[model samples]
Target chain A: MFKGKFVDNLPKIYGLYTGGFLLFFLAMMVAEKNGVSAKMIGILFLTFTIAIYALIGVLSRTMNVSEYYVSGREVPTVFNGMATAADWMSGASFVAMAGGIYYGGYTYMAFLVGWTGGYVLVSTLLAPYLRKFGCYTVPDFIGTRYGGNFARFCAVLVLVLASFTYVTAQINATGTIASRALGIPFGTGVWVGLISILLCSMLGGMRAVTWTQVAQYIVLIIAYLLPIFWISWRGDFGLFPHFTLGHEVARIVELEAQYGLVKNSAEAIKAAGVPAGLAYINVPHAAAPEGAMAAWKFISLAICMMVGTASLPHILMRYFTTPNVTSARRSVAWSLFFIFLLYFSAPMLATLSKIQLMDPNLKTSIIGKPIDQVMAIEWVKNWISVKQAFIADFNKDGILQLNEWFMRGDVVVLATPEVAGLPYVVSGLVAAGGMAAAMSTADGLILAMANALSHDVYYKMVDPKADVRKRLLVARLLLIVIGVAAAYIAAMRLTSILGAVAWAFDFAMSGLFFPLVLGVWWKRATKEGAIAGMLAGLISGTWYLIYVGPAFMAKTPWLGIDHLRFGIIGATVSLVAMVVVSLATKEPDAATQKMVDDIRIPSGKTVISHR
Target chain B: MATSKHEAHWNDTKGLMRITLALWFFFSIVIFMFGYQLNSVKVPLLGYPLSYYMCAQGSLAAFVILIFWSSGKQQEIDMKHGVSDAERTED
Candidate 1:
């Protein structure tokens, strides 16, 4: 699979990714070393990054339905793994993740564990079987597994709802990247991201999207690694950040003591746009409470993340592009390897940023010093001008206090290069990297929603006899519609990237997890059981979040669990509903049983016997 | 006779799945849920606290090894039972 036609094209793509990065890296360096403005560096980086991904989309252009749908199922394991990694690491993972850890502290490692562990679930439980089924989308699996249109429709409903929330996160990330990188208004920046996303996904679908994602993975990983590498070397740890980050963590703790701050706590110092009351609740450094309630919440949030990762529509669709069931499994391992390169580095980045932040040399004026005197630092001036970070003398003591310094979590990774006094081009590179992360995931998500609409709704439901061209046309149109709608939602930007992602995961884990896991593993799961389980889960999970969440968070917790962890409740309801319904009703018919058995074996492809 | 052999293979597969899934649950959920205790006992191998090492890198490494291990083991089982994808797809 790796040696023939595909292998021949590998060098050219690899060369393009590496060579183009070097070329741009040099250009940005020389421009910055000269008298070019910082804003120009940002604009240059954004333009080059978007152009490279857009070019990949153009180069892989195709009108064939199969190619548009699943890259014609010919993608090699390595490339598919790379593409999947790119798709998996969204803007949230790239930009906000480190800052999340910085702000949320040790307990927040749940996001890391949940996400990486979920890939294991994919390779072991879901990906190989789905590939064997040779289905077009998640709904196709459900529709066929249960032998009913109602089942298919329900799957489509969950797919659209979950993928749309997930896509809006990606678009929201894109807006952040554009606003930071191109120096544009966030609302207009979302449109820029939308246009770039449309270019990569609208015409070429999965085929174009996959190759573009591979390019994007390369850019994002490099963008992510270089600044961290620079920070480690500057800190005198040499180039091995992973091996030496532990020492840095110890030093940072020591520094915290020196600065009269709480040891081992990255407390939120600045509250931007958050009310004072709500701000206090967002503190990360409270003493660890070992109550059962805390333990349950921790376990529930982790489960929601893991289950949600395995069941996400766009991530699952990446497996459908692999050549065979084995490749699907292997591709998932490869995805983990690539993702680990970034995920493993994020905590270290957080520690390093924290160290830079705690440096007394960079500290504002001491007691009785004027606030204006503290504002003279270059990085302080830059960040304050942008309003992304602040160090106010809240006590009017004429001096900066430890708690007086406040910065947004999302800006930590982006601002690390600058805060560490690295070259301005490196900051630009981080912005570009953040853009790649956002766009690659957005491309995959838009395709997933469009597939559910065009394949499941339009082709299967509206026009069962539609031709390939017509189906492709419908997909393209739906991609445009969903893209714009998602962008508009992103422009609204209701929540933080991590918050939005958690909600998306909650929806996916609660509503889709049982149906997906059961469809492959259990033959007794009837269509009726599947439908009832999904709706019960969806309605209960969403209803709690919309109606009871605020009151629940503000007052007494519902059943002693917060709204962020409501997916646990939803999953429980879903599991009970599925089991009871399956027991009360007839099992799946013989054909469906055979389908389940065949998927388990992972041998010859299961033909999609259309009803 | 073939049906009985296939059933035995299926049983073996199920047993293997249970063992692997147990390990999965421990690393992914159980360890994190009870991480407070482990986090307090800081084993100094890599200069960071033991808890930080486990949280940041160790769990992820275990996940990678587990996936690779499971995939390899499943392939062996499939081949031994003569139900490998190659066998099914062969003309």
Candidate 2:
């Protein structure tokens, strides 16, 4: 009577997981009641959740190449959707995005639109077609379609550059979060997290990674929603914060009026008969570009992110797991929907966190208070002790004035529960969720880069006679090497977590966007043209970024185009190169044109293969 | 496969692509063109500046709907041209 299939048993398994999670939540609360210290609670969360992930990794370990490289290419639409969502919402999105909106306000919304809107491109322009191609890695597609080893090598080089930048950003987030939870220094925390990252992905391969990501997504989505639900309910903002959140936003605008923080911090408070005070305790880097420049940056960043989303190798790779082209399209839709659940609530989370810290009615309010008294608040005491926030009476006015008080934007999401007077258990949950976000993203990126290098460069180019086992071994070695290098770079704290991530998106879009798009849609695109585009875009973009910004320590942005939006320059130049070169050179043969035509069609057996 | 049949289906798919791009551009770009000015114009019911509300909340929801809708619509176009995977599986 109980001869149920594995797919039928899936719901039962996840149901049991949810029940176990609830019990753990209660156990933590009970342990706190029994006088367990908050530090132990945080430590318990860090170890417990990661232990579960590690266990999944260990259990899913495989030696099979099909299972390792692409999960045997049979993942259902829904699970792939969940895994893709988990893959997409990295530490930057789950933790830092709301904080970005909290401090940067409206302009940062570009990230939300750019990120989610990119799915439209994915379903229409890329994902479904990639599934039809049926390649193991992106460069595999470039090699076969563009008709040369040199073109494929260029694709791998671009993929490594983009994915490596992205992995470092994810590692930076994981390290910061590990330090916070373990009570270790940031540098130590990063290394500790790096060991766990390697342990998790090194054994599992692709199929196991896919399932582990789904489990992580569940923990992550729950960890994300509870604080927002509680905050909105406490603030009397109704259950649907999306609709009622404007009430809180209206208050923030009024608060901004009182502070006069930005030149465009909405209308002045004097118009509403409120006195404008010195805007102490304000966003330090809140100088938004003025008028026309603001609009330009907003559109440019959104365009860059959207293009990058379509071009990101890891995200595109997820589609190859879907059983067929139709599911690939459906998977993109569901992935966007799952991601929407968080991006939709970010503004409310940002507003709620901001209001809690500043509103006089809330007990957590700190600005305009006596410096010593503010320090005595338990949340302040906890965070300040950990160095997430700081305050001092620098002017000797005995008050924590604006510049004298500072908090990292990274602290906004993690500390919101404490800032709202919730139990310590909630903070632990948020940390687990943030760590999962970082881990899942880092896993995908490290694996994508390693797979491309080993499959495309090592096996296909360096040693075509290598067997599947040898190729898999080389991939594992590449994983360790890439993971270690990324961890070291991340420890340097090159930039804010969000800034680094945005630059990665810019890099991916700049180097790969035109070639991939035109190769599929425009059959005339040739090997030489693709090579020219990738080199011109990648080289020009990287040079412009370091020349104008902090990574290589230079200054002076041309036309006020900051380093983060360097994709605008790189992609534009790349498109021109590809078009001009393709027109000037020989058109591809009929066989290659027919290959492109087959990719565009929805109904097809796999047109290309990689082993 | 008939060459004319492939060309005909491509034309239909291209129409759907145009519609998707138009909406994507609207929600992500056009609405935010006059962002600073829109900050002064609050949504009467929601009480957020029109630009801020659209950027943070509305555009995301629109994106979710747009993708699902386009996916479903594309399937119909595929079925019409006899190019869908479902048709292949049945054969």
Tell me the tens digit of each residue's lDDT in model 1 across A366-465: 2234567767878768766776666655566767655556666777787788767798899888888889999999999899989988998899889999
Worst 10 residues of 2 chain A by lDDT: A271-280
DockQ (C-alpha based) per candidate is 0.50, 0.57
lDDT, candidate 2, B34-58, per-residue tens: 7777767778888777788778888
Model 2: how far is A281 from its true place, Å?
5.4
Query: For model 1, what is the error of residue A555's alpha carbon versus the real structure, in angstroms, after optimal superposition?
Result: 5.1
lDDT of 2 by residue, A470-519 (tens): 88899899999999999999999876677778888888888899989888
Model 1 stretches with alpha carbons more than 4 Å out: A1-7, A255-289, A361-373, A551-555, A609-611, B86-91
Q: What 10-residue stretch in candidate 1 chain A is worst by lDDT? A: A274-283
Q: On a 0 to 1 TM-score scale, where does candidate 1 land against the true structure? A: 0.93
On the 0 to 100 scale, the lDDT of residue A388 in model 2 is: 65
Pairs that collide in candidate 2 are A281-A402
